[model samples]
Target: MGQHEKVATSLADAVGEEIGASLAPVDAELERLYPGDPGTRQPVHTVYVPGDAFAADTVRSWGDRALDALDAHAPDAASFAAVLGLADDLAEPVYARVRAKLEREPVEDLRVDFEDGYGPRPDDEEDQAAARAARLLAEASARGTAPPYSGIRMKCMEAPVRARGIRTLDVFLTGLLASGGLPDGLVLTLPKVTYAEQVTAMARLLEAFERTHGLRPGRLGFEIQIETSQAILAADGTATVARMIQAAEGRATGLHYGTFDYSACLGVSAAHQASDHPAADHAKAVMQVAAAGTGVRVCDGSTNVLPVGPAAQVHAAWRLHYGLTRRALARAYYQGWDMHPGHLPTRYAAVFAFYREGFAQASARLARYANRAGGDVMDEPATAKALSGYLLRGLDCGALDTGEVARLTGLTRADLESFAVPRRGDLTASSG
Candidate 1:
């Protein structure tokens, strides 16, 4: 067999074995309880760093500086709003001192670390943490401010090991959920996922949590971090990811490309060069393809290097480049993560750019239809015909706003109503 075929066979076998070993009888109770998407609905962009990277002092300093910089540069209500939200959480007073210096700072996505292993927690500790996180969330929610997006990166099983014990992993995840559930669309990022069973195990825990908390079933969602040699070698990696999504039913929301782990697995130099190496690209493609049309988002991993200088220009440029790359990915139907607060601009830049481009293209197309001939002022049939094509194309490409379509087409609000109405008959007939 060809190399690709060989790889496919191996992955299929591995996944099959995992599923066979772990698959429980279908839970009709669970399925009926959670019938639709039950978790955070917003698109996720996580910011991750090792917890050990900062001491208590550094965190305080950084938090302070971030708040100060945000106050000055945000310049608008929404921007200022996000800045103010971080005021209490900035790492240090120095961060606050320099906060005024940073402009257009990014909002924190999800924070990640492996400070604790995945295992069960004492009920008391779990309750305390849950209460704390809940209080913070309530305060933020009441202020109409977004909470800091957070997540935990648990320890990965070392290689040469047959499999990581599921019970150990379960305890860890249980503590997180029981600790007052994840804060507003919390993401549990699993590293080094090599088989579908790993995804299933996680999903099952979420199911159990939903039962215990009286939360809607499937409310516990997670993003899988693909970073293993065996995972990359799978020809059907994309399909595997898709299957995982199906298994989750609706809790799964995003897939992230884990560059460092995958690189180490392949014996590639785990350096700056590895971020976008060919293998990494291949793995990203697998994730993208699998996530396509599933409504589950995908994100490219971070650039390990950090930029320097106070001008924020260097940082801005890095962000812009990163945003552009992410925009390209988004255009292909994927979004990426910004690992640091500094990368926030890049994240927003990419999202806004995509929306702007999509809007512009959609407008241009609709304008063509608005000017088409058929009647005194405009041709209803001709215009409708023209618009039908534009509207479908726009929606397909993630240009989700229909109001913009109405504005550009000059179609009466009523005529545009049919924009969302599914088309019947041939494209030409439907338009007429």
Candidate 2:
């Protein structure tokens, strides 16, 4: 034996057991609170249409309009690339995919907005609209014409509209029940959440709906619209978004930043009110940080700029929207709200270009990591996890073909996930 190697301390095995026992509750709590990302497909953009205007063909119409916009303005990869400053290497592939995406799955997520976009309707009028929304969405889903995710954004839980909001949601869900069943991709949004209590109320309402319908508990989850400053920070100066997640009782699926509303709430002038505004960034940063490891994604808000008018004007608007979408993606906010049909071209263009631009490097690094082969850029398990997620997201959004990803990395989707996700035991197991 080596000198000094045989030396022993006065430590006992019971001491180790004691520490483990003391941490048992905390381990359980952490696991319960942060189960990690669900590893499901997250849409890249959520398109909002006024509730009263949503129809069975709305999704298809949006796709056609986006294609038309591209045909009229861009006409080809070279022209589209000029608009967005897409690199020459990325132009053709991204342009082709953007068109294909618009044709196949134009709207990844669609929200029927009853909150601000559709405002101040009579009780009977709103009631009928809610039911009609459900009917239309159900019909679209049945006919395989609906977006992957479809839902409504109801009024907030404020005192003036709490009952009305509840009634609207009740009518919508009940209407879906009458029209066969809830769509598999159903999503609901509760807008203007300023308090954790409001999240709790929404959770309780969903629970009652489940009980009444004999649906599974937690079957429904909603996105929390972060439109007010109070929702980001509480009166006590703590992160209210974190508390809202806790109060949601595990039913919050996402936190969507309301660009204009949030900016206005912070007193940002209308001209300066944008998603990239410092005020908006702060709110979304708080939201993103709070949602980390909690399986709730944070979505960036949309730009009000519409790509319309003459060729030059449309090109300029496309530049802004494309730049904004690309900026949000780089910031790790993978999803955003798309406000217009014309926005779709740039939205997909940016997304496709983003992933396509990085495809080679990401693939090579993932391959190296998968093979445990040394590379210039050293990667740890955490970095590997991020790389896997990036590729997966790119694949999910039609930016990267599944076969291409597998060929480049020599890994299947399941194989990537094996490295991407961390199990509970991996978090606390003793390292030798």
Q: Report, for all candidates in order, the number of backbone clashes.
A: 22, 0
Residue pairs of candidate 2 with colliding backbone atoms: none
Q: Candidate 2 on 1-432: residue-level lDDT in tens?
A: 657666778989999999999999998998889999988899999998987888778998999999999999999999999888999999999999999998899999999988899998999999999999999998888888888899999999999988999999999999999999999899999999999999999999999999999999999999999999999988889999999999999999999999998999989999998999989889999999999999999999999989999999999999999999999999999999999999999999989988988988999998998898989988767777889999999989999999999999999999888867867565345242
Backbone clashes in model 2: 0
Q: How do the predictions measure up, each by TM-score? A: 0.58, 0.96
- The candidate that wins on lDDT is 2
Off by over 4 Å in 2: 1-10, 424-432
Ten contiguous residues minimizing lDDT sum, candidate 1: 96-105
Global lDDT of each candidate:
0.50, 0.92
* Candidate 1 Cα errors over 4 Å, as ranges: 1-44, 49-108, 115-135, 148-151, 155-184, 235-239, 272-275, 310-327, 330-334, 366-406, 409-432
lDDT by residue (tens digit), candidate 1, 231-317: 545565345665666666566767777767777777887553455678777777777766654556677766655433553553454
C-alpha RMSD for every candidate: 14.0, 2.3
